[model samples]
Target: MTDPSQTPSLDLPDGVAVTGALKPGYEQILSRQALELIATLHRELEPRRQERLAARQEVVRAIADGEDLDFLPETASIREDDSWRVAEHAPGLVDRRVEMTGPTDRKMTINAMNSGARVWLADQEDANTPLWENVVEGPMNLRDAIAGTISFTSPEGKEYALKTTDQAQLPTIVMRPRGWHLDEKHITVDGERTSGGLVDFALSMCASATLQLEAGKGPYFYLPKMEHYLEARLWNDAFTIAQDALGIPRGTIRATCLIETYPAAFQMEEILYELREHSAGLNAGRWDYLFSIIKTYRTRGRDFVLPDRNAVTMTAPMMRAYTNLLVRTCHKRGAHAIGGMAAFIPSKDEEVNKAAFEKVTADKQREAEDGFDGSWVAHPGMVQTCLDVFDRVLGDRPNQVDNTREDVQVTAADLLDVKATPGEVTEQGLRANIDVGLQYLATWLTGRGAVGIHNLMEDAATAEISRSQVWQWINNDITLTDTGEVVTQELVERLVDEVVTTLPGDASNYEEAKRLFLAVAVADEYADFLTVPAYEEMP
Candidate 1:
């Protein structure tokens, strides 16, 4: 075990401190040079990050005060002209058929690399709870993996090590940092907290950019939770500075932005324009997209209030509009349009696995048919099914970028037609939402960010959709068609208590989960993101 006392005191910059424990060998990843570069980025980019976050709050306030969400009339010409295109794909990122996403712990790193997927998103964001040990240890594992020396053996004696043969078939490593809205309280610049997104990005980029290039893969990223083109502009600027400082070529780093925010959904063209020199593609951040819509319009009437989380399929009128717009916008601008997550995980029971595969196949089939370049799954078991569907469409070809989806034309009304999604608010949906929220939260409290729930992989975003939907349903007094139960704070508490009986775990953990769950689920103001509060409870 690494001793905290033996490590030399880091010559941290003014206003910064080692808020988290400096584990053994933390110095290797947090070298003096890397710290200085991160400080430079924090000093340079954090203020802009604060401004962008304020801009997001302003939008939320407008929607809260009866203003309708719509496209920016000012940037319509960028959307109309349609002549510009983002930079071509980075060399290693050309054929992304099945990208798997997970927290960047040691075991997940080895398995994800060997998952037979085209890309592995080393997530430091939604899928990961920012426990300090995890925050520091995650990159250590990645650094080793990049150097072909990563291995881990469990206490149970199950051993894992990187294989040379697997290296050739391993997924391209694309790191995803935290979003702009979060602050890295552990590190500060001039007594102010730095943006968590910049901290994760800077540390990883400063450490790995040149080395990745040497390995024939430029530093690639998946930008998450951006609410505007201005945020993308900020990242592009940061990329230039980092590259120049590191002596890497300009435009060598590529990023794929997740258009998860409702406001950003309207500015796809402008977002790509801002990152034109370094664009990879955009993602249909489907789960978070639902959470975003609710966060924006929770106070609006029933029209904007969604039915149930399960009922909002990709084919729902508004969802179809969003996905269709993504493929069209990305293909037209010469960027990849990656699809959403297939959260299905297999099981021991043949019948159970069969059902999961059937659901996942139909989902992947639709995405493949709709012109998505690639999609994601939660487990390795779902990879071949996604590959087969996309393979039938993209036989002998790495990608289908040449298939520009010209038949798609989406208007702003189509995007804002939230009430058009058909489904019933019901007793079953309410119980499921509450149950999923609590179950996932319990596991997260134990320092596990991703858990299998109902045979599907559930991440922080899954719980976000759950908790937010619960709050939305309660605030709206949504009526359940099946049981005629009106969702209320009192009723929700009762249901949570009932769910406690069903969840299999220590009573203490479930007790903690219940208390935290209700605080977010029953609060008058929507909690921005569950991970923010959950991180406070971590060791």
Candidate 2:
């Protein structure tokens, strides 16, 4: 086959090498044409991605140096302009009241679609581990799913497939690629690695966009961890280029930016403005959002330090402000404002499941009442509860976009109101944090990105927040309210030892998990994202 990178239209980067021979199923998804599309995109977008990453550090430095984090003064005009509206949601995305998110492994791909949710987020990012098989097979699974032919049979003899319902009845597929900070080292161009986000988007779009369109959906995406509006702009331009190259109409590629970063929370309006033409909406995300805050403010002051991962609920002052601003900005721009994740995985224990269901019900009700057009669910079992909540509020309506929260007036102070959260640091919270982080990292290193922990679907963001809380507690010399114990390196090390001994998993993987965890949590400087260094050490 001819080299896709050699396509005359693409100016391939010199010396760029495509290492790691294609895996078993890679050819179907990573075809010559698909590779050329990825190469072309890397040539077009990676430079801007680098710049945006650097821009992120500038904001972080400013926050760390005691400079206030808030909406950009220069972009005030964009925020003030209220006339702009995003493109209409494509047909399949109009009623995303209950969306399920999971990695695109064969079993998950089939189950998520068959689950009664309205949409399935085929995640190649947080919900996915970037192993070689996962990177290549994920798109293959999606391509088949889009074509309505995906099925999987487990070794235990259970089989999963798309339901016999009409194509219109299946959950719409929205692909989520990796964030800017990650690299697809397995594939290289001009002897250097390309952005993982570009690789995931290009391969999936090239392989499945046409199939999705033929089935009434277009190439939709859930962009994660974008720190600036310009990053959204970069994505918008890439969408334009890819659509043009594929001969699809402009705006065919719709995106919902996950407002999961500290910087992004302050620029929701501006983010919509940048992606207006291609924007389907903005999503409120909590894990990575909390991680960003604790990661950035680990050293600033006690006020900036967060108490505990589990204790910091959406009712927290900063979280409330962020969600309110997200819904308002999205509606004002004529986009669907998706709510945060319902990570509860139903359990066999009746009491545990009952309590979880109650918590999810209240959470979904709060979001629906707050004007969220839709929300995300992690497992199939929780879908109906979410759907029911939205159904009660949105009777005979596709969305509550009309119910814009005009009363919301989130200011810089509101966005940074970390001190208002009513929670006290405690010994139990510290031990829980340490145990969760260690457990998550161990599973992550063993090739699982999303894990069920304490009946919740935890991901990279959970581990991030977990270890970050420990680091902040240790660095700030925080005292536990219940035990009166001051968090110190000695105490953390002792806790880590105890947790590692009790952690369930392969013992060797646990050791590696602990080493990586300490590198980020106990180091002199904070790791921007835990997965950055962990990705390198991914054996």
For residues 216-294, what per-residue lDDT tens digits would candidate 1 score against the true structure?
8878999998889999999999899888888888999999999888888898888998999999999999889999999
How many clashes show up per model? 0, 7
What candidate 1 gets wrong by more than 4 Å, as runs, is: 1-8, 165-168
Tens digit of per-residue lDDT, candidate 2, span 130-233: 87778878889988887778888999999888885366888998999999899999778666688898889988888889888888778899999998889989
Task: List runs of model 2 lying over 4 Å from the truth.
Answer: 1-16, 505-509
Error of 1 at 83 (Å): 2.8
Model 2 is weakest, by summed lDDT over 10 consecutive residues, at: 6-15
